[model samples]
Structures are given as C-alpha cells and as structure tokens.
Target: MAEPFPLAPSLWATTAPPGPETPPLTESGQADVVIVGGGFCGLSTALHLAERGIRPVVLEAREVGFGGSGRNGGQVIPGLKYDPADLVAKFGPERGERLARFAGSTADTVFDLIARHAMDVPHRRAGWIQGAHTEAGLAEVARRAEQWAGLGAPTRVLDRSETARLLGTERYLGGWLDGRGGAIQPLSYARGLARAALKAGAAIHGQTPVTGLSRSGSTWTVTTAQGARLSTERVVLCTNGYTGGLWPGLAQTVIAANSFQVATKPLSDNLRRSILPEGQVSSDTRKLLLYFRLDHTGRLLMGGRGPFREPRTPRDWAHLERIVGKLFPQLDGTAFDHRWCGRVAITQDYLPHLHEPAPGLLIDIGCQGRGVGLQSTMGRAIAQYIATGDADSLPLPLTPIAPLPMHAFHRLYVSAIIAWYRLSDGGIR
Candidate 1:
C-alpha cells in the first residue's frame, strides 16, 4: 500500500476549534439519512436537512474538510470549470441559463452563509481577475467578458495596463474582472460549515471509514470499518476526490489529480498595497492555470498544476516557488511559510455529476477544480431532492451517468496532455 501523504498544517488549524469526533458506528443504528464524506457537500446537506427536522448521520474517513474542501486554492470564483457556451450547447438555452445563474449565484450563497452563520473564514468579495498570458488568451478573455456582461453579469474587460496595475505583473496582456467573485480561507469555511451542521442537530463522525454498504429492504445499511453499522432510509455519497473505493463506477468516471500550492511569508505593507490594492484574487487563463491571492495575513498564496496522478511525496513545491518568483521577481528569495497539495476530481466533460446509482442512493461527485462555491449550491440542491424528489432544484443538469471509456488509461492520458500543455506554455509548438 502507498504511504499516506503528510497532512500539512494550515493557518485555519490555529483559527477554528476542532470539531466533535464521534466514535465510529459500532452497532446497527437508524437515521433518516446517512451521508458519506464530511466535506462541504455532506456537511452542508446535513445542515439543510437538520434545519428541516431530518436528522442525518455523516461518516467521514478523515477529519472534516480533509479532502479538497479544506485544501483548495480558496479562490471562490464564479462559474463551472466548463464554459457556459458549452453547457448551453449541451442543454437547451433555458436550462443553460438556469445553470449559469446557479453557477454565478454560488458566490453569493457562500458569502451569505458565512454572514448568517457568523463564520469567520476571512471571506472578501474583492472581485477576481482572469488574466490572459498570451495574445490568443487575451482575445478569449475579452470575448468571455463580453459574453458574461451580455448575460447580465457585471464584468469588465481590462487592457494590459489595467491588468498590470491590478496583478502587479507584466506577464499578462489583458483580462476580465468579475466583481461577483472572491476568495476565502477554505479550511476555515469547511469547519464553519461543520459547526453550523452540528448546531442544527446533525451528527458528524470523523475518522470513521465506511467499509460496506448494502441495501436492506427500503433502507440502506452502512457498515464502518470499526464494527459499527447504520441503517438509514436514504444514503448520500458526497465523497468527491477522496472517495477511496466506495463506489467503483463513480470513481471510474472521475480522475483524481493533485494540485499543489505554496504560500510566502507575509508581504511587506508596501508590496502588498501595490500588488492587489483592491484585494481581489487573480488567476491566469492558461490551459494549466496559475492562481494566486493575498491571504488574510497579506501573504501571497500561489498555486498551479502539479502531481498529475495520485497524492505522493517528493512534491515539486520548488517549481511553484520558481513560478511565483517569475511572476513577482521582487519577491524572489522570500521564505515560504507553507507548502501543501490536495487532490481534485475532474470529470470527462469537466463538470460535476449528480447520479442516482440505485434506489435511495444519491451520488454527487466530480467538481473538477471548482468545488468551493459550487459545493454549497449542490448541497442545497441535494437536500431539496431528498426532501421532495425534485431534480429541478439541482444547479447543474442531471445527465445520465456514463463512466469514462477505458478508465485504466486515464493516468497515462492525463499526464501526456498535461505535459503537452506545459510544453506549449514554454513556447514549444
């Protein structure tokens, strides 16, 4: 067996109090719902259900937000990983408009929840800039901005000078600024969601891995590795990237890719003021994108493509450091305060999936790289679906579940494609 990756200590570790760690299910118990995975989706769903007087039991293999929910770039930018145009092409214009609205409104939902729950996750609606690193990329960014504006979003296209003024880098030609987008401390947000769920009367069990799941009559029996079992009327699988092997078919449809990030020591006031004067999170528009933002402590957190396959040691944090230096040469030689990596699930079409694998079974996975904002929206949708059996409440279209063709070859295929993109970025045609 591969050794488990070391859990990097996060700033949130010091901020939020530890959540309650319920002992693993020991004997057969019963509940209204059994939720798998304690990340944002599971926790948010539990909270919603609890509010509606439905008690839910959440089982998490690791601590809450132990997956991408806690370790993401924290860029709560709007929209899905795939383009809105593509979604419109796939689904009709009306459904596509609704999906777009859901994606765009996701940021509001996140910030609203933080406010209503008094969750101190250092959230800032500082807007976000989608930088364009090349001439073609710049044109595309302009086109996208126009499309968004036409769709009633408040987006503006910025020239090279404006881009440089906002980003403190000459690396990009131009970009788009979407005021609706923002950033947050991801782990803190996840923990806040857990606290909210707990306060709402939901039970969350950490360090409890579900070993076996079997259908018994109208109820589903969930057995934990530690000799505990729960018989529930409904089962929700919100495992996402850290799904482990619970549902093999769902796992096959999504590839777990590792994304790494490094944070520098707090920047000097002068440098911090100049880089992001407006306090907006920024990301470049490359196939393998580079995302960065100033944390609550004024440190520069930079992240990009990395660890293409499984989560393993010997991470290339140095590569991230070099990239950061290239983007801000003045920050060269600055000591990094932390380096970490996490896995994100990417689907074939680069979209999230909500599937009904069996009766009373609802599996939601594949957020690609945009789970932070979308997860909450998905949680609300799932809760409504479970409560009223209405698929129309979902944010994204619920298409038929089609597993990836030739699943075993994903690693090789993804690695090669990533290498090609890297080489292209390096000016190799």
Candidate 2:
C-alpha cells in the first residue's frame, strides 16, 4: 500500500491540527446513503446529510484528506474558469446564471462551514488576487473585475504599480482582487469536516477502498478491499482525480493532472511584510498558471503545473523553487521546507459535472483546481438533492458521464500543451 501519507512531509502535515479517529471498515454495513472517497466533497456531503437526519456511510481508500483536499495550494478561490457572461452564453441565461451565481458564492460556503462548525482549521479571508502576466491577461482580469463588481462583489482592478505594491513583485502588468476569496489550512479543514460529519452522526471508514460497485435489485452493493460490503439505496462517488475503475469509463471523463508545490521556511517579519502583507492569496492568469499564498506562520507556498504524474525526486520541484526566487529575489536563499504534488481533475468542459448514469448512482468530477471552495458548495447542493428528491434544487445541472475522446494519450498531449504554455508564459519566470 502507498503510505497513508506521502513520504516527503508537507507544510500542512507538519503544522495542521490533529485529525480525528477514522478506523477502517472491517465489517459489512448498511446505510441510507453511501459516499465513496473522503475528500472535501464526501465529508461535506456526509455533514450536510447528517444535518438533514440522513446518516451517510463514507468509505475512503486511504485517510480523509488523502487526495487533493489535503494537498492543494490552499487558495479558496471562487468561480469556474469561464466568466459569468461566457457561462450565460454556454448554458444559456437561465441555468447558466444559476451556475454562475452558485460558482460565485463557493468561497462563502467554505468560510461559513468553518465558522458554523467552529472548526480548528487555520484560515484567513483577506482576499484573492489574479495577477495579469500580459496585456491580454490584463484585459481578462479587467473583464472579470467588471462582471463580478456588477454582481455586487467587492472586486477591484489594480494597475501595474498597485499590483507590484500588493504582490511584492513587478512581474505582473496588472491584476484584480476578489474580497470573497481567501486561504486556509486545507488538510486541517478536511479533517475538521470529517470530525463535523462524525459528530453529526455520519460513519466514516478510512483505509477501506471500495473495490467495485454493483447493482443487486433496487439496492447498490459497495464492496470494499477488505471484503466488507455496504448496501444502500443511493451511492455517491466523490472521487475526483484519484478516481479509478470503481466505475468503468468514469476516470476517463477527466484528466488527472499533477500539481507540484513547494513551501519555504517561515520568512522573517520584514520579508513577510514585503510579500502579501495583507494575507491575500494570488494566482496569475497565465496559460500555465502559478498560485501562491502565505501560511498562518508566514511560510510562502507556491504551486503550479508539474510532471503529469507524482513527482519522483527533488528535481521535480526545481522549476518552482527557481520561480519563487525570481518572483521574490529577497527570498533567493530561503530554504524550502517541503515539496509535494497532487492531482487536479480537469474536465473536458472546464466545468464541474454532476452525472447520474444509473438510478441510485451519482458522480461529481472536474474540480479544475478550485475544489476547495467549489466542492464544498457542490456537496451541499448534492446533499440537498438527495434529501429532497428535487433535481431542480441542484445548483449544477446533471449531465451524462461521457468519457473524453482520445483519453489514453491525454498525458502526452497535456505535457506538450504545458510546455507550449510555459514558452508562451515566458518560460517559467
């Protein structure tokens, strides 16, 4: 078995609060709702379901926060990749606007969950800044700011000088800030959600991999690796990037791209003040983007595209370390405390998808690096739909699960695209 956690320590694992007990499932079980994967979405789904008096049984192949939920960049950014107007054009004004609005409030869903549960997760809602790497990028941020402001968001566009002052670097030409976005201790948040769900009467079993999903009459039979079975009327698959063949063709619906990250040792107060002084998280608008933030103790974390699979060595993070020095020359000699990687699910549509391929079987995929906030809200919506049996109550419209065409060669094509994007984005800082 792959170790419960990555061998190389992450900054989160070093500093996060102790997680709750999640014993493995060793016996057969029964449930009203069965949730596979114990990441943000699954835990949040269980929490919401328990709040509605529906006890859900969550089975995790490893531990909670074992996936992207624990390994993400920790930026709680809101909205999908597309702009609101574009969304309206794609899904039409009605369902499109609903999705846009829903996407816009994802950050609120996250912070609210932390506040509502009084979770012991370290977090700050200072804001999120989207730095523009070029004139075209600047135009995109301006459009984003204009549209979000029209929606009553506390959004603003910053010119080059202002961007430099706020971001501690003149690398970008301009940018926009979204006051609704923020940062959090992601692994801690995941563990907190698991705790909250357990307190609400939900059952969670870690190290219990669901090997297969089969139908037996009106019930769905969930078989785990340990030879235990869970029988339930409804089964929800929240496995995103780590999705396997539990359901044929499901994993092929999205590409699991590896995101590499590095965290520097806590900076001096002067260095910290010069960088993100107000505690805002920032990600630039580049074809191959870079996202960064400061942890509560002032450690700078940088994340972006990396190898298509799990990084094999320290050299896998050389690009990020060099880019960090370029972005903040003052930290040129700063020692890095951690280096790790995780998979981000990229859907063909660049939108979160809800799939109901069969009755009592529902699937959600395609986080696209915004899973921290998007998945939280999606979990609530999914829980609401399951509890009320009202499909219209869902914030995202359900779509059929169709595998991506030419999926097998995704890694080759994606790596080529990343290389091209890197060249276009000025070749890694």
RMSD for all candidates, in order, please: 2.2, 1.4
- The window of 10 residues in a row where model 2 has the poorest summed lDDT is 1-10
Model 1 RMSD in Å is: 2.2
Native-to-model Cα distance after best TM-score fit, residue 339 in candidate 2, in Å: 0.4
The sequence of per-residue lDDT tens digits that candidate 1 reaches over residues 200-251 is 9998888889988899788888989888899988999998888777775778
Clashes of 1: 2
Q: Which regions of candidate 2 fall more than 4 Å away from where they truly are?
A: 1-6
lDDT of each: 0.83, 0.92
lDDT of 2 at 3: 55
- Evaluated with TM-score, which candidate comes out highest? 2
| Residue pairs that clash (backbone atoms under 3 angstroms), model 2 | none
What does candidate 2's lDDT look like per residue over 269-321, in tens digits? 99999998888999999888999999998899999998896677788889999
